[model samples]
Target: MAGVGLVHQGRTRQYEVKVTAYVLFSCFVAAMGGLLFGYDLGITGGVTSMDPFLIKFFPSVYKQMKLEKAHENGPYCRFNNELLTLFTSSLYLAALVASLFASNTTRILGRKTSMFLGGLFFLVGALLNGFAVNVAMLIIGRLLLGFGVGYSNQSVPVYLSEMAPPNIRGALNMGFQMMITIGIFFANLINYLTAAQENGWRYSLGMGAVPALLLCIASLFLGDTPNSMIERGEYGRAKIILHKIRGTQDVDDEFQDLIDVIEVARQVAHPWRNITQPKYRPQLTLCSFIPFFQQLTGINVIMFYAPVLFQSLGFGDDASLMSAVIAVAVNVMATMVSILSVDKFGRRVLFLEGGTQMLLCQVAVGTLIALKFGVKGEGSFTKSEADLLLLFICLFVAAFAWSWGPLSWLVPSEICPLEVRSAGQSINVAVNMLFTFGIAQVFLPMLCYLKFGLFFFFAGFLVMMTIFVALLLPETKNVPIEEMNSVWNSHWFWTKFVPQEVVSDHSSSNCKPSP
Candidate 1:
């Protein structure tokens, strides 16, 4: 279909572009931001479990840990200190606040600028965390890291979606999540290698700087997307970059579509307010709900506390960390499955299948834990039982990696129109951060009280979200970004909310440009 133009229903000729090396390079650079985020996610749990790190920053927790080893406390209550949890959750609280401001920054300064600034902030934060000698310094460093994550998470997915060819957009956008899984695997591997060394926690936390530096230097050389260029009124530069990325000069049809969309976007003085209008209800709902549901999958709590959870399950320190490494390795491999088949299999199929797989795994794991350690948490798992538990947990992680992990970021970024794209993505990031913060803060306490019931709670949410996807989410495979509104206009439930005339006018204007 590329290199040949075809007129559809008397509208302007439609042109498809080939993926060029420049586009791949730009996407790879942008996805480095996710590596920074995922490293932080994986490193914090391992660092918290280290004896030296706990003795230095959380002496109370270290005392509790020692007492639990002597069988003086319940296994569920060993690491339930509020201050210890704060060390991990504070970053997400900061990220939630920063994401709101990042929306405007991504819109005004462009996606590349936001990414560059994010790298600088992450660089500083990583250094501060590496050298921190007290709890205050460590929390401050975490806050800075949160600001960096907020900015990058808001922009990178949008940049990837805008730059990728329509046919491969889902696969390209998933590069961000693929990087996240790889980062988690690397962090867990590093933690396993460094756990026996002196000041090993510092090494695990500080390695985040490597990806930050890479993203910073790479973003400077990469050109902004054509959509972003047009949004900023850089018409000449937009066409030049479009031709270069598309690998052809016959980009007039796609170029004109971008211009027409920007003209409509320019008329709206307040994008935030515009997103709240009734017609945008579907977009707003997806932005708010998808991230919320993704967190309820319990993936973060597992990723954030894998080492601690394994320790509480009666694994020795070295064994616990090794289990975490294996689990994260499974996560990385499963995410590769998503990148290879997302566009081919489509989003909804992955969502439904993965949700069912995760649901079964969660219920099985819960039953195993409940049978091994009853309500009082006084029992321990046998060797065979512990291995079976690990197997189920790995299965759950693999299911999520191929489904919700990547789609959560991809769908929200691609669904929103240009006018509300930044704001929609900001909302997505904000909701994600908010839920992540809440879960991080409460997980330890919930573990203390709820015991084995927590997984069932998450499984209940998984059921509801799977049904939501099947009924509400339409197929978006191979749809051009500029024509996404047509998806809502045709969907059974969403069509009533979206005005047909508005959709028609927008499509016609994009297809048949003005004289």
Candidate 2:
């Protein structure tokens, strides 16, 4: 199964050099997409308060413009329930549509260009939203903005993963996911501070422009993946870029390594179709479900609906908004822990540890919420009751942030071989975003309808997720992409699990790396 033969050399000075400093510098610049994602999702929580502020603070303008009716459905507007929900969830609606096209768009435009397009949409959408006078106009801005986010969410990781070295792959790839949490933390903090001010929602919406401009500027200097360059047959160009990316003066050796990988792809005859052949079966299974099940566990539900969930706890605006900010902070901090542990502890351990921890936290939160609403009754909570409920929910969010939040993005990038990295990453991302849209859209209504029981439902799903991770996922901490086929073809998979005949060793060497 060592088709190209194992090239292991233990730890060397090469590992100490921080090869990705410049590459990750570029990564940091491109990660503006995540900031936009976090800001847009979390901004709505603060934006909802705008209707009340407009009604009370901007009364003459509110009445003159019919903005007062906008809050009729909630505190801001009771007049239009559909419009209110649309205003609240329009990003998800656009994200769902964008997910359908994002992969194809990235394929045609290439990663860097795709990200640039996303930035353009974000910029226009932010301006439109800042100036929107009606619900229809806000929806248009959100739809355009979500298109950019959907594209970024799908393309950025593949780009980063393809560029990252194997040993630190999880750390770098997870950084993209980590930026998302940081974006949320930053967004929520901005909103919390601004929520009581006049026209604060406009400021919050317009804040998206900050990251959009940075992304647009950053894309200009960024390098496309070596895989992309290889696929396009720009080998000499890929070599030069890889030198700059790795920050090495030695281009000759690196060029040969890339060429070696590309040659493997050439022998496979059809790299994409080989994913279904017995040898590539492990990668196929990991690619499809690693991401889909990540969503099935219901992380997005919490992210998209944290405010509503806090409101259900009988907290007032100040308490709920403050708690949401804390939750975002917890998410950011916990992900940092994962970043520190992922390389040392390995992927399988992180998932097992994080998933099980998350399951327990969900169960406790579920029980607490159920007991609070069902046993204590919903009219008003005792001081202690409110505190306990808040503590439990915070713990639940912390658990998710540490475990699924970053690792879900990290594992998929590492598991697929170089031959199928981009396409496989695209598939995984498409599944994640598609489910993210569906789940984010329904979570609020499901909670409104299901009430406290929603926690228990999610808790059950969390357990299922924990079990699947324990039973199926391989530890990929040090496994190089070229060696993945060995594990994929093992008898453990061949006899006991997947029953397909493994692709012979002779054929494995032929699956070339790009360009």
Candidate 3:
């Protein structure tokens, strides 16, 4: 905004610029946190099914049933159903609680530094989980994993939001979530490859350490976010970082803006309460509610329990696990669509369309499940119905992957002002994990009790979600970070849904344009 020429009435070579290595590399390392997050989510269903894992942790169940063969299927194999639920949801509980203190962590340590610490803990947790001998040990491992996830979840997106140029910000941030899908696919592939071995679960769980280590080491090369440096009154370092990230020596005006904004914080006397002030309240409200609905979309439930969900849909154990793999793979492919289209389509359109599609898929899944299970009874899926179920599930997976999965992380990351961004992102991510905890804790049970009806709950939530997006969600496609507040304050219908550039209203000009 300083030396950068933001206004362009026509296409130019400069306007079609490519991303720099520094931004790309920084996001790459930072997004490894997401990779580990996905790895943890995916490995659970596969690892829990591992015979050696069960025999090691639930010896009582193993001995009580007098089971001898590894492939044997019986009640003994199902001994730790509730315990597995605890294992799956424990990290989110830790994430929800840890986020309260994350603001302090990010402020003191710096964003990249916070991620480094997160990666360290993730490594610790992954190793512990890999070697766990009891339920308590496994739970402890998940707690550490949850803490690491909260730290990185809070840091990475905001870090990317700060560093990336606004023109491709949505696509870049969406790519961060795409890395998550890759992690899920990688974990599923590992599980599928090793689900047959006696002690393969250990290998599958331990593989999480590879990305953790990569993140920890790669993050060391990355600099602190320009926002974080500016917050600490490191003007010299902040200017240098801006120049390096913005790829221009003429960043003085942008640097001056940072100084001025921080001075505003000083004048406030209570900067911690700044976000709750009327001026910032709407965006804060957006930050708070977005995460609630994001989880209510039930993406986590599907990600965490795809194998189990497929099993209930009448697939055999091996087939169910394979179906979960296909589901994750589809998720990755769909996220690619988002990564390419988000900046082009604008945020508001995708949010509305994707939410509606997900709602429809939920209805279809519920209806088919009701028809198959309610009318015909359980374990009675016709081949035609089974094919349709998988089709609908993949479509649902695609719907979430392209729309909610990436946007959930992106919008909230950039929605807050820089002064409160660390805390804001942390709070939103914490809310995400909190809802994820409850939903996940309830998901398996609902599948058991509600059977086909579990989807209606998701659909019901989506109805509200779709309307909210259409009415309230702001289009932030190419808006610069400094101008996010102005975006939130813009008019309700006519201008907000359309990017400020395309709209005739000049009132939204408060935001600094990206060159």
Candidate 4:
């Protein structure tokens, strides 16, 4: 009896520790989705600059076509800047297409399989992109890469949310976005280091294959979501997987919870249909538009065209690439700060503060450009003036990284209930891609025609986002996601009794779902 009692005690402690560890472990794995997403964004910036001779580095099939070099009238007087941006935007275009079916893919393939397929696309596409000799081949590669990124971006958050302990879901999901920023930053740094070397850009583009390979390997080890397993009629396996993941010995309560969620989801009708229903409209609105807003902030314009932007500021090619590296470094560091503060500071505070900081930084940048470049003098800002301009741009990227970058996804994941999660996320991701595509197409023309006024436009959007978040968005840190809808619907009633910041406490018996 004494030995049995000690064994039971040891098991209980092990279970306690594993619950947190397993969720975090899953977060680490899911974050590869974000890493690949970032890698796609980073690689394109460097690759686009070397377009004409890029064919020379490719295999024979891809190496045949080259940009028509002009004669003494300056070979390539007008660079195909617009076409290069289109190539960059092609990834988002593919993402838009993939996102339309991403939710269905998740329902059919399950999260693990969907992620695995995403990785497969990433590996194949990265290889094809690296060896592309023509624009058509490169665009096709981008399309494949986009499919991978879109699918992973759509599925990874859902996987993390389903696997996480309710109390820490926000933090874990935010980690996905942080990984994205870090991935982009890392990819840019690699490109900068290799910018002067032969095939440097090609190798940079190929680096996306690494995370895809890692994700493919990791998926083989992770168990499918318990909810997905139960929905697919694999209850016994789900129960066992939940027991292992959550480290619960009895597993009765957790199993029941899973069953209840699966049943609710089953009765919810086609998840996409649920979004148009009255009950889900608010969440649909929040999820879809938040990501849309994040993209509309013109961050991608900076990422895709940073080298061009810096050159317009009077820096030569080397200086422009170096400045981009500095901006990317600042972005990476700011994401680290966001990860540390996400759990402690609360989502609302970060969004509010981050938005405000970006507004100021963007305004400063716009003012500098208006004063320096808008007037046609020496055709550029002076060196010190250029340095100050780069500083503000770095500040803007850093501010965006810390707040909008992570919170956009985290908030959406929390705002929607499990019954409509897959559909809601799909719509959100679709909007994200659409805006990414639209901005990529229009921004260059806007920059060429409207000049400094474009910043004012984005600044106005930021102001609107700030106001919307302050009045309507709820603080979701530490809240049980199942109860979030109810809290949001009756926030006025709850605020009368509970603190405004405390949405739902899992420890309280009263936190049970209403009948």
**What RMSD does each model have against the real structure?**
2.4, 5.8, 5.1, 6.8
- For residues 1-515, what per-residue lDDT tens digits would candidate 4 score against the true structure? 01100011112111121444666777798888888988888767666555333445332212221321221211111123456667788889898889878888887778888888888889989988878777788888999998997888788888887777665566678778778877777877787777777777778877788888999999888888887788788999988877766665665655664576567678877788867776665677688779878986768867877765665556777887788888888888898788788878788898899889888877888887777656331246678888898888888898888899888888887677677888888888889888988887777667655677778889888898888778767777755555565455455533343333323222233223322
lDDT tens digits by residue: candidate 2, 244-331? 7766655454455556666666566544576677655666777778777778666665566565456545667677778788888888
- Evaluate model 4: give its TM-score: 0.86
Off by over 4 Å in 2: 1-20, 53-83, 104-109, 251-254, 263-279, 375-377, 494-515
Q: In model 3, which regions exceed 4 Å deviation?
A: 1-18, 58-80, 268-272, 375-377, 493-515
**lDDT string, candidate 3, 88-167, tens digits:** 89999998877777767787678887889889989999999888777888999999999988888878888888778778
Ranking, TM-score, top scorer first: 1, 3, 4, 2
- lDDT ranking, high to low: 1, 3, 4, 2
The CA lDDT at 504 in model 2 is 23
Global Cα lDDT for candidate 3: 0.76
Please write out the lDDT profile of model 1 over residues 1-515, one tens digit for every residue.
Answer: 36322222334445758889999999999999898888989998898889999989999899988888564347888899899999999889988998999999899889999999888889989889999998998999999999998999999999999999888899999999989988898988899999998899999988888888888988999999899989998999999999988888878777876787789988888888999998998899999999999999999877999999999878889989999999999999999999999989999999999999999999998898888887877788888888999999999999999999999999999989899999999999999999999999999999888988988989999999999999999888877777777778779999988886545244454454322
Question: What is each predicted model's overall lDDT from 0 to 1?
Answer: 0.89, 0.66, 0.76, 0.73
Q: Best-fitting candidate, measured by lDDT?
A: 1
Per-candidate TM-scores read 0.96, 0.84, 0.88, 0.86
Better of 1 and 2 by lDDT: 1
In Å, residue 136's CA in model 3 sits off its true spot by 1.4
True-structure RMSD for candidate 4:
6.8
